[model samples]
Target: MTTIEKALIRLHEVDAQSRGDFLLQTLDARAKVIVTIAYIAVVLSFSLTSFSGILLFAVFPIVSASMSGISYGQVFLRSMIALPFIAFVGIFNPIFEREPMLVAGDLTISRGWVEFLSIMLRGVLTVQAALLLIASTGFQRVCRALGCLGVPQIFTTQLMLIYRYIYVLINEAIRMDRARRSRSYGRRHYDLSMWATFVGQLLVRSVGRAERIHRAMLARGFDGHVRILGHLRWSSTDTAYCILWIGLFIAGRFFDLSSVLKFL
Candidate 1:
């Protein structure tokens, strides 16, 4: 696919994630943020050589995605985006540690592979959990949640501004891409020089547009504080939601499901 097409497709996928009608989507932002943080902490607490229990924790994402109306494909595709960076970080595990960690009959598993798989599994869990959060709660609520969770207002405001304007910047890029396509009949792709010029012009245009928007906001009484989040009380439903999931998380943290199932 073309670069412009890929950008538009990703934007569409993001839009889909933001518009679902699901239980997770209806929860208080602060509750969701707190629970997500707790879930992630539990997922990461497992030892590197340990397995199975962490895999059992996959239920969180699957159930969450189901509740959030997010398809497996959507979560998988979005989650895969982080694989490269995680791979880069964990790539040296197998090379550096080759001692045997587990053995079954003639089958011996090296600590390196075990640690490597553990890292990848942890990455997948965290990524899916985060994507589920964004998909269910959307970006605006996420900002509100962070502010309510005592994250710096400055950080939340900047994040909100960036997310709000990113669409405008992308639309500007689309216009430029269309303009380029119209002018270049034989070759749709621009040369490196053309790209450089396009980027410089895009930067200039973006700055001017942003300045105008900022002034307009200021003229309309744009206060520095985020007024998006009202006073949120922890409702009974929110309490129940946390209890059910965090209970499961705590249970999974201490027990390996596979081992338990072997007894049954």
Candidate 2:
């Protein structure tokens, strides 16, 4: 299948997962959002060299994904998209700090390397947590939850629009690609000028399409607020869920559970 088709399939898969009857799917979206935010904050609060301390944070995403029936392999594979950039951003750590942190049979590992690894681990964990959230609780619900949590309406609205607009953008690109291929007459590649023209045409088409979409929304009483169907009732289960996870997060952040276990 084509790239766009694959992307659309992935999008549908996430939607299906979100709608599935699972542990997290049953909880209020606000609870999930708040817990996710707390998870990220705790993950980021670890020191650069405290890799072992931060390793405990992985439990949150792993348990969450498992309870929610989300596939760990899919989340890990999808989260790899951010790995290269994360690696690039941390690649210089080894050069800046050469102090030996660990010694194993004459081989020495530097503090910089530890820091780099810690950064990489943190990024992977946080990305997985985010992917799990979107897969478990639909993005629309998450955005609505954010707005309800006092996040600016404009930001949440734009985030929702940008997410939805991606499908439209990709569909438009697919149409343009098909047209380009049909007119290429067996010629595989287009010149720079032709590619530039295609880009400009795509932009024009996208703008026109967006305008039509906006008009349709306005016609349907499009208020600036994001309105999801049904009320978000925070039940006792949601309260327990939030309390349990947030408490775990706080404990994980302040104490090295691994060390405590070792001592025990």
Off by over 4 Å in 1: 182-192, 229-233
TM-score of 1: 0.89
Question: Each candidate's root-mean-square deviation in Å?
Answer: 2.4, 2.4
lDDT values of the candidates?
Answer: 0.83, 0.88
> In each prediction, how many residue pairs overlap at the backbone (N, C-alpha, C within less than 3 A)?
0, 0
- For candidate 2, the lDDT comes to 0.88
Choose the strongest candidate by lDDT: 2
Q: How much is the lDDT of residue 178 in candidate 1?
A: 81
Query: What is the per-residue lDDT of model 1 for residues 36-117, given as tens digits with 9 covering 90 to 100?
Result: 8999999999998776778888888888888888787678777888888888888798889999999999998889888888
User: Which residue pairs does candidate 2 place in steric collision?
Assistant: none
Query: Cα deviation in Å at residue 51, candidate 2?
Result: 1.0
lDDT of candidate 1 at residue 140, scale 0 to 100: 79
TM-score of each: 0.89, 0.89
lDDT of 2 by residue, 61-175 (tens): 8888898998788788888888898899898999999999989998999999999999999999999999999899998888888888998989998999988988888888778
